[model samples]
Target: MDAYRGFVMLLMAAELLQFHRLHEAFPSSVLWGLLAYHQSHVEWAGCSLHDLIQPSFSFLVGVALPYSLASRLGRGQSLQTQFSHALRRSLILILLGIFLRSTHREQTYFTFEDTLTQIGLGYPFLFLLGTTRPRTQWIALAGILVGYWLLFVLYPAPGPNFAYEAVGVPPDWPEHYTGLAAHFNKNSNAAWAFDRWFLNLFPREKSFLFNGGGYATLSFIPTLGTMLLGLLAGQWLRAGLPARALLRRFLIAGAVGLALGLLLDVTGLCPIVKRIWTPAWVLFSGGWCCWLMALFYGLIDVAGKRRWAFFLTVIGMNSIAIYCLVHLIDQFIINSFHIHLGHGPFQVLGPAYEPLLTGAATLGVFYLILLWMYRRRLFIRI
Candidate 1:
C-alpha cells in the first residue's frame, strides 16, 4: 500500500518537470511526445497517466478504508467515534480543496472537480458502504454506475441547434453528439447541466457557465463508483486469499474492465470520458487501478523486494504533505532555483531545455523535503 501510494505521489510530484514544454520544444521527438502525452490530461474522450492520478489516489483511499476501520475497531473505538473521525476527515478534504482552489482568488472557491473535493463529497457514503457485506458493496457499485448512466440517458441529448459552440465544442467536433454517446458529450451532459444550476447557488462574481475544461461537479457520483471498485480490492486483500488467487483476480479485473470500456466506447452505448467520470470510465480506469495494485503488491509485499522502493515509500508516507507542497510552492522553488542558480544556468542545454532543468531542480527540492519528513516520521495525515 505504501509503495503504490508513493508511486502515485511520485507522478504528482514529477508534474514540476513541465514535460509539456519539452514536447513543445521537440514535437518530433517520440520520447518527449510520449512523456508529454502521459503527463497531461486528455481533452474529452480517452485517458492518460496523468488522469489516473486522481483515480489511483481515490482508489487507494478506498483500499485503505477496510484497514482503517479495522484498526479503529481493534483499538476498541466506538462506532460514533469512527463516524466522527470520518466526518471530520471529509470536511477537511472539502474545505482544503476549496482553499487550494482559492489560492490566488480573493474568496473561497467551492469547486468540486478536484480529486480531494470529489473524494470528500462521496466519502461518507463510501464509509457506509464499507460497513456492509461484500455482496452489498457490489450491489451498491452496480446501482451507482447504472443509475448515473440512466440519468444521463434519460436527459435529452442536445439537439442539432443546441449551440455546441456556446460551450466551446465546435460544431464539427469529432466526438458523437447524437444517441447515448451524445448524453456524455463535453459540457452538455446531465452532470454539466447540474453544475450550471448547482454552482449558481453559491456566491460568485460572475455567472457560472460551462467549465472551460469540461469537468463537472457531479463526476463525484461516478467517482464514488471508482472507489467502490477499490473497496472490493481491499476486501479481497483482507480476505487472506492465496497469493496466486489474488493475482488472478487482479488480472481478470483489468482484462474485464478494459474490454468492457472499449466495448462501450465502440458500441457508443457510452463514451469513455474522464472529465465527467462516465460509467465506462469508472470501469476503464478501475481496471488499470486493479492491475497496478496487483503489480505493486507483488513487488513490495509478495516478493519482499523492498530496497528499491524506499524513495517511493518515503513520498507515499507523506502523500498529503507532498500534494499540498507541490501545489503551494512549485513556483517558489523554481524561482528560487533561478535566483540562486543563475537565469542562464540551463542555456547550455539549449533554450527549450531550461524548463526541464529548472523543473528537475524543483523536483529535487521536493524529494529532499519529503526525505527529511520521512526521516523524522513526520507524516502529515488528515
Candidate 2:
C-alpha cells in the first residue's frame, strides 16, 4: 500500500519540476513534450498521469478502510465511535481542501471539487458501504454510477442564449461535443447547473460562476464509485488468497474495467472525461488503478522486493503531510533555495532548466521532510 501510494504522491510532488518550462523552450523536443504531457492534464476527455493522482489517492482510501476498520475494532472501538472519527476526518479534509484553494485569495473559495474535498464528501458513505457485504457494495456502485450518468444525460443541455464566456468555456471550443453527447459539454452539464445554485449559498468574492477547469462539486458521487472499486479490492486483499490467485483476480478485474469503459466511450453512451468524473472515467481510471495495485502488490509484497520501493514507501506512509507540503510550501522552499544558493547551481544547465532545477531541489526538501517524519514515526492522518 505504501509503495503504491508513494508512486502516486511522488507523481504529485513531481509537479514541482515544471517540465512544461522545458517543453515551451523546445516545443519540438519529444522527450520534454512527453514529460510535459504526462505532467499536465489532457484538457477534457482522456486521462493523464496527473489525472490518475486524485483517483489513486481516493482508491487508496478505500483500499485502506478494511485494514483500518479491523485495526480499530481490534482496539475495541464501537461503531458509534468509529463513525464519529469518520465524521471528524471528513470535515477536516473538506475544510483543508477549501483552505488550500483559498490561499492568496480574498476569502474562502467554497469549492468542493478539490481532491481532498471530493474524497471528504463521499467518505462517510464509503464507510457505510464498507460495512456491507460485497454483493451490497457492488449494487451500490452500480446505482451510483448509473444514477449519476442518468442525471447528466437527462439534464437539458444549455440552450443558445446561455453565456459561454461567463462560464470560461468558449462556445466554439473544439472540445465541445454535438448531439446528445453535448449533455457532457464543459460547464454546461447538470453538475455545473447545480453548482450555479449550490455554491451561491456561501459567501464568495464573486457569485459562483463556472469553474475555469470545468470541474463540478457533484463529481464526488462518481468519485465514491472509484473508492468503491478500491473498497472491493481491499476486501479481496484481506481474504488471504495465494499470491498467484490474487494477481489473477486483479489482472482480470483491470481488463474488464478497461474493456467496459472503452465500450461506453466508443458507443457515445458516455464520454471518458476525467474533469467531470464521468461514469466512463470511473471504469477507465479504476482499471488503471487496479493494474497499478497489482504491480505494486506483486513486485513489492509478493516477490518480497522491498529494497527498491523504500523511496516511494517513505512518501506514501506520510501521504497527507506530502499532500499539504506540496501545496503550502512550494514557493517557500523555492525562495529559500534562491536565498541560500543564489541560483548559481540551478542556472548551470542553461536558462530553461532553472525551474526544473529549483523544482527538483524543492522536491528533495519535501522528501527530506517526509523522511524526518518517517524516522520519527509521525504520520499525519486525519
Q: What TM-score, computed on C-alpha atoms, does each candidate reach? A: 0.98, 0.98
TM-score of 1: 0.98
Q: Which stretches of candidate 2 lie over 4 Å from their true place?
A: none
- Scored against the true structure, residue 252 in model 1 reaches a CA lDDT of 96
Candidate 2: clashing pairs of residues: none
**lDDT value for candidate 1?**
0.89
Model 1: per-residue Cα lDDT over 1-382, one tens digit each: 8889999998988877788998988889999999999998998899999989999999999999999999999999998898888899999999999888989887777788998999999999898899999899999999998999999999888887888888878888886557668888888888889999999899887878889889999989999999999888999999999888898899899889989988988899988889889999999999999999989988877798999999889889899998999889999988787788786987779989888888888888888999998898898998
Model 1 ranges with Cα > 4 A deviation = none
Residue 322's lDDT within candidate 2 is: 95
- Candidate 2 per-residue lDDT, tens place, 134-204, comes to 99999999999999999999999878777889889887889887777789999999999999999999998
